[model samples]
Target: MFQVALTGLLTGLALIIAVGAQNAFLLRQGIRGEQVLPIVLTCLLSDVVAITAGVFGLGIVLERWPSVLPVAQVLGGVYLIAFGVHAAMRAWRPGTLDAGDGTAMTTGRAIMLTLALTWLNPHFYLDAVLMLGTVANSFGADRWWFLAGTLVASVLWFFGLGFGARLLRGIFARPTAWRVLDSGIAVVMGTLGVGLLAH
Candidate 1:
């Protein structure tokens, strides 16, 4: 059990460390100090749902659904790539700062968008559901330990990201900082999309 817990913890944390669309958006909101908590909470909760689904046998089901998986991957990848390109373009030609005051990034729609961006991604499902599920199932009755570890990692990661990015709030006050961030997000999204397509 101890070993299983440790393994699950390490795997979960390592996977979350990747700079995906979800993480990028979280950082964006964090820098603006807008809707950070709700966004983070939604992210963590969605992970909980995904991981729990995995532990309870959703992974096996997903693995069998070959057609669905590829479709999801393509759709999610296209959306991410498009969104990234738009963000990059916006960064290159940013409008006035006052426009940000009424930006949609702080609304419920933004929260839902981020949640969908994370949860709807097939890569996320593959990692949290299929991969983690396979690991938990390996332990049989001890799968509970793996689930607990994963849950802990999810909670820790969301809080850390949500709060840690806050440290850069002042730096983000400058318009150029947002541009840099958008460009970085564009790169990460495009790379991930291409990688998914190749796979």
Candidate 2:
């Protein structure tokens, strides 16, 4: 059980640490101090749904669907790379804000955007649902424990990312910081995309 839990935790953390489209968006929203909680919660919930599907043996079905995976990889990879580039551009060119009070997002819009970003990415299915599921499945009955541990990690990570960004709000007040963050995001996302395509 302990081994299973540790493995799940590590796997979850590894995947979450990657600078993907969803995460990039999350970070940007965080910096902007938008509807941070709603966006973060949606992302975390999406992960829970996908991870549950994978741990429940849906990953095996996805593995069997070769065409699905490739198409998804291609589309998702393209989206991620494009999103990265866009972020970089945003960083390069700071935009004037017409809205005040620091709230640029709404609950409905946040849910839709987060859901699309989190769910539409095939990489999410491949990495979190399928790959992580496969690892958990190897433990047989221990799979439940592994999944529980992983879910806990996910919750912790999402909350930290959402709320913790508040601590850095001051830094984001400067345009230079946005430039740096977006440029770094672009590099990371581009690298991840190229690597995925290579594989």
Candidate 3:
């Protein structure tokens, strides 16, 4: 059980730590100090629900439906590419990272955007549902242990990302820092997008 849990924990971290729309949005919110708690909670809860669904049985359905994964891949790749371009543009004209510098987004608006970002992306389904589920189910009776590990990973990552960003406040105070960060985001997104399409 411990070994299975460790596998799940590591796998979950590997998947979740990648560059994606959800993580990008979370980072932005964390840096801007805008609705951090709600956004983090939304992401964490969404992951939990998706991962649970996958581990229990949804993964089998996804695997059986051969066509669904490809379609999702195409859509996800396109969306990721577009998002990468947008991030590149932001990097080109980087902005200050002060709390007041960000657009005034209400908690409601933030939650709505969070939902859209989390659910609308096909990659979310691929990772949280198909991939994670299939992997978890492979553990047989110990799958629940794996699920628990993944749950821990999700909690740690969301909280770490949302709160840990505060530590970077000093570095992100400058426009150059924002540029570097956004540029890195752009590269990661674009590369991942291309990888998805290629696969």
Candidate 4:
């Protein structure tokens, strides 16, 4: 069981460590030090739901209804492209991501955007629901332990990312850094969007 749990932790880390829509957005919020707690909690809870569902039975349902993934792909792809464009615009005119009252990137808006980035990505479902679920189910009697391991990984990651990003505050103090970050985000989002659409 311990070995299985370790495997789960490592595997979970492997999957979540990848740079994707959720991570990108979370990283930006983490750096800006704006609404970090709610955003981190949201990401963790969302992962909990997805991973638990996958470990239980959602993976099976997704497999049986293959059509669902394609639909998700189209939707996710479009959203990613739009987000990429938004990021590009920000990069072109990088500024402080003010967290002041009545600002554009309000807490509520940030949370909603985070939710969209999480759920709208087909890869999120594939990795959490289908892939992780399949692997956890393989653990048979120790599947729950694996679930525990994955949850732990998620906790460590979100908390670390949400808080740890402040370490880079020195570099990001300049608008140029923000511009570069946003530019990279734009490219990532646009490339992912195009890939999903082509798929």
- Leading candidate by TM-score: 4
TM-score of 3: 0.82
Writing each residue's lDDT as its tens digit, candidate 2 over 85-163 gives 7767776676742112555567798788778667657788888888888988988989988898788888888888877
Of the candidates numbered 1 and 4, which has the greater lDDT value? 4
Q: Write the residue-wise lDDT of candidate 1 on 1-199 in tens digits.
A: 8888888888899888888989987877777667778888899888899999999999888878777788778877887888788778868875532125435565787777787688658889989999998888889999989888888888888889887887987777788877888889889888777766666
Worst 10 residues of 3 by lDDT: 94-103
- Candidate 4, 147: how far from true, in Å? 0.4
lDDT of 3 by residue, 1-199 (tens): 9999999999999999976778887887788777899999999999999999998898788778868878767876777787789879988876533445445878888888788667756778888998899999889999999999999999999999998887878877788888888888788778777877998
| lDDT tens per residue, model 4, 10-93 | 999999998898889888888888788888998999999999999998999999998999999999999999999999998887
- Strongest candidate by lDDT: 4
Residue pairs whose backbone atoms clash in candidate 2: none
Worst 10 residues of 1 by lDDT: 95-104
List TM-score per model, in order: 0.90, 0.85, 0.82, 0.95
With candidate 3 superimposed using the best TM-score fit, by how many Å does residue 47's alpha carbon deviate from the native?
1.2
lDDT of each: 0.81, 0.77, 0.84, 0.89
lDDT of 2: 0.77
